[model samples]
Target: MTKKRIFLLLFSACFVFLFYRIYYHPETRARENHDRTRIVTDMKGRAFQVADPIRRIALLGGPTGQVAFILGVQDHLCAVTNTLKMSKLVQEMYPAIKALPGPRTTSGNINIEELINSNPDIAIAGDIDGQIVLDKTRIPVAFLEDGMGEGMEDIKREIRFYGTIFQAPDRAEKYVAFLERVMHLIEQRTRDIPVQKRKNVFQGFSPSHLVTLGGDTFMQERIKLSGCENAAETVTTIGKRTGLHSGLAEVSMEQVLEWDPDILVINYGKPADLYKDPQWRNIRAVRNKQIYSQPAGVFIFNRPTAESAVIFPLWLAAIAYPDLFENISINGIVKTFYREIFDFDLTDLQVHDILLGTYEFKMMKGIKNRG
Candidate 1:
């Protein structure tokens, strides 16, 4: 009798536990039936169960700001953690960015008091800690798998989601269409180029041999799209997860020598002082005088920010096949993007410089490819 009772009790407990999980599991949470499913956002095991397609927002990073504008919700943005380097459009709308502040840490992360003061309806952040911040703020925070190294599709999906949320479905559809069109143009332009004729790429982070993008990075993928081959393609090295203090992958002359990349691409802000380094001289890239310095903000993944996504591909197209799209005029691209997304015109060179990474953002975009 005791054994039978015990069995029954255990079965009841299991049933209750499963019932609780079935209802409370983050994975099973569902978004509105009207939401589009073009892009599958893997929300760290939690599905993007967007309740009301989020209106008044608080952002923990700059990308959300860009996305807000892209989705035609520049006015809907209630607050953003002020550490972001804002584009001219954002700066104009929220001049309060100069006064905004936030916590910069990897632990016990909490939302900024100012963000709470703004009384946001929704929150957007990058990590679990950011979610903790939203929890503190008492709002639902959407954590995106963000980075400069993220795929173009991932970015477009984000754009689509933001568009859906802000009731700007037309803008989102157009944005995705434009991205596809631009990418197709770039691909068609380089389709005829043979492997040998293409550039051999070495993505560098520092003049010091320590700098590198791993096999899986968006910048590396961009290089591939531009008809360039990454020197680190065959290497078995992985990079550190820290901000910009990225560690090395077994520093050795032979590894660089074996790659013999024709063009060395480093994130902008690296002072090219490596030309003075004796150790850097032995590098085939250095020897061939093929080292190229990217604009300050063009790195996307290894450097996680929104600016890189806008112009990083343009930089890749310019460097990889200078002949096809050489003049490198961003005026048209910039003008179209501004008009399409925000209905704003950024004509000031200084503003463009800051937005386009003419200055150091002090981070590298992530890697988009693995092999």
Candidate 2:
């Protein structure tokens, strides 16, 4: 054969070999890895053997889904709860998330049929209902504790838990380090502020403005961590009963008027509603326009999420004590958070829109704007 023909044949053979190694080799290795299983202990202290790679996941809670998204394992999410589907942040950040199938219930109850049909390798649920899931689909269900008593630590653990589950322990560790750094910074900045000087904050949840968080809730810890005292701390009804009732409770308007918080933080109501209301006008927060709506990101900042564990304290501290944190750049913190955690490159406008909750996405239906 001619030397030219021999050279061309060698070149074609090399090209074909490279393509096979690049495409088929990795896929074959992935299949081999997927078949491997390992035993893991979930937050509920239950042990189960899960796929090594955990290629598909079903999230039973919105916050859990946010955690997965933050850990950069969202590509593995096969199914999510309806609440996550309704989240404005999720809609904006991952438009494709809406196309995924969701369970039937809105009350944290997973639909067995939908979950089975989705065919996730494992499932992460908010509550410890593993038997129900196991009985139905034979899928190992890992329970993630809702952030309540431990505050920031709980969120960090949740992040690390999922990180381990999805084989992204390095990413989880990085985020935990970021969380600890921010927490330490806030602590150092506000540590010396005396109890008497801390801002008294009232976190209103419902339209009635009567349902507020108690001291034991995550929001209360967030407030305290931000160098502010919860105004509703005096309310004895909250956290009195067991279960979820302890986190939130109803209070009368007279009781709130008595508390007379220095700052009002509403999770679901417009600023105009408080500013224009006759009863609220006399309150210190309303009179001074100190009422600030909690910013909603992947999950509501007022609520618990890994993102909120870091971001909420910074945002609240800046608002509560501006002079002390004047040197801290909240905008920079937010920009870095989105870039690192969500892997989304946000422009200045996008960052502002998230902070202000005015990104022009559809507001969660039936939920009033707290801004």
Candidate 3:
């Protein structure tokens, strides 16, 4: 054959062989099988595909990691933010998670290089910045709605979504059912309490800045469910701004004094300082020592968590209506919650410490400390 013809033929043969290897070879076919995935529409209405058996996951923001833990799928987590690692219950239950690498913020702001290096099949992000994850990484990103300001239905929806993604729908449904039962039981017990009898509550976020729970936020719902009225429900603006917002609403100390709340619930400040502060001495809660600190578990009780949805209201109710819920033991409830959701048994002393806000995992030097 002519040299030109031979060269052409050889080139064509090589091209065909490369094409087959790239598209039809056994390795390619195996990869195609592994890539078999399903579409999931997140809370923000963004749709994305994830691997069929999602083995490794990166949780960005929101309580996606916590929800995953609740659904019994935390074993799939490969990369988690610093917030998840800092969770007292999570560290206690899964010590190995302390070594995972990722970002630290809950706003879906992550280290792209570390995240990509982690090789997570999928990334779940909070609704606020999920799009950033998609823009920055080759990994598939799914967004979950902000659970903090949402209701129980939203929590259940997130639970079901995580369950479906992890192929654990049954477990998800069981948790949702448990949440429903707990919510219903609290409602049934406190539904008929007179409004006049319900305590007026002030939720403190800090010492100098006294932020209270607004009526529209989930914290307000929690306060109401606990048979207490939010002292700041009437304030329309936060931090002197004229607009609605979720989470803590910054109010003046004068406004708090005007509301004159009967009970004080603090998340950031020390109860002792509040009680001793000369400026706060006149508040009813301070004089009576009705101040209570929000509990911290897998996550802070003040923030949203699948676990907190059940525990926060119940704990608050027990405190708000002690005469009615006197039979409920906060320690027992904490034990049962940890036992049922996490399958981690807690000693009575541990439960007591958790209630007292002293339950913390010994700080471990791990991925977080590494440069």
Candidate 4:
């Protein structure tokens, strides 16, 4: 009885060892790791399966191409939308992108044949464009959040998502930390300002002086971060669409006179235009000559992008309350951020031009307003 039991136990042990050696060997584990696919859930809550080490990408959405550049994955881009190409600031930073193929227009029109020829490993896009690309091509598509919502978390969320997709989490975390530092600096400086004393800001968008951003867009985030109030905060998102001018709404001249913001940061006409125009003479911003042109960098701060999320609030704070930020050197900050994060060296004159919004004016010259 004892011999029989011992022999059976030994046989069972041998079978267990053989099974472990076959399935859990080092070489087998390595092969599984190499071939394993990852599932990523986009902001829209759709799940997508992506293969490891994505080598080729097609950016088919707004504000994402610039983010790819931020993540240091711009070299892997095989196709992009026309929005990036249309941005004069982007052209200055990454001139090589001019040669890249734009298979999708910013308006969500896709040229399937052109996109197929590009043969990207993955397509990162907005909901509509992403679905269209998924339907038309065999390539995997990852959707992104279209609007930036009410605060800073959404911006960070998008960046981290891109980091995962690009396999550059370290780089993305580094950028996020840097962004938080800048944001904290702005908050510390402006936190002490009394709510009653904070200035009221109105953002006048492009194409028409009366066209402005409402409280629903990222523009409100910029104003609030700068320790100021958005005079247009009461404007509803009744007619908002999902595109370049998503949360923008047109207000009547009577409305401007009613709000009478203390400062007007515009993307269109100059301060002088407001002062001379009889229709705007009674507004507090015009009466006090507190009009300022909004700065434009890789893209206009009309919407949120990685660059805007990091830099726009700081810039706006400096403009809204120069006395509070007297000790901080915004010029140096802008120069360092562009040089270090963007890998683009900015001259002192270039920094000055950007701060004063002259750079935007120069780039926009002769180009009809797109809004």
Task: Using TM-score, give the best candidate's number.
Answer: 4
Error of 4 at 143 (Å): 0.4
Best-to-worst TM-score order? 4, 3, 2, 1
Tens-place lDDT per residue, model 3, 288-337, is 99987766566656556787788888888887778887777767877887
Per-model TM-score on C-alpha atoms: 0.70, 0.83, 0.84, 0.85
Top candidate when judged by lDDT against the true structure: 4
Q: Rank the candidate models, highest lDDT first.
A: 4, 2, 3, 1
Global lDDT of each model?
0.57, 0.75, 0.72, 0.78
Which stretches of model 1 miss by more than 4 angstroms?
1-55, 85-94, 101-108, 134-137, 147-149, 206-209, 235-239, 243-254, 268-272, 297-301, 304-307, 326-331, 342-344, 348-356, 361-371
- Across 149-262, the per-residue lDDT of candidate 4 in tens digits comes to 535788788889888888888878877888889989999999999999999988877656877877877778778988999999888653465565676778887888888899
For model 2, how does the per-residue alpha-carbon lDDT over 77-185 read when each residue is reduced to its tens digit?
A: 8888776776766777889887988873444366777777676778787553455676655667897786456577777787888888888888899889888888888
Comparing 1 with 3 on lDDT, the higher-scoring candidate is 3
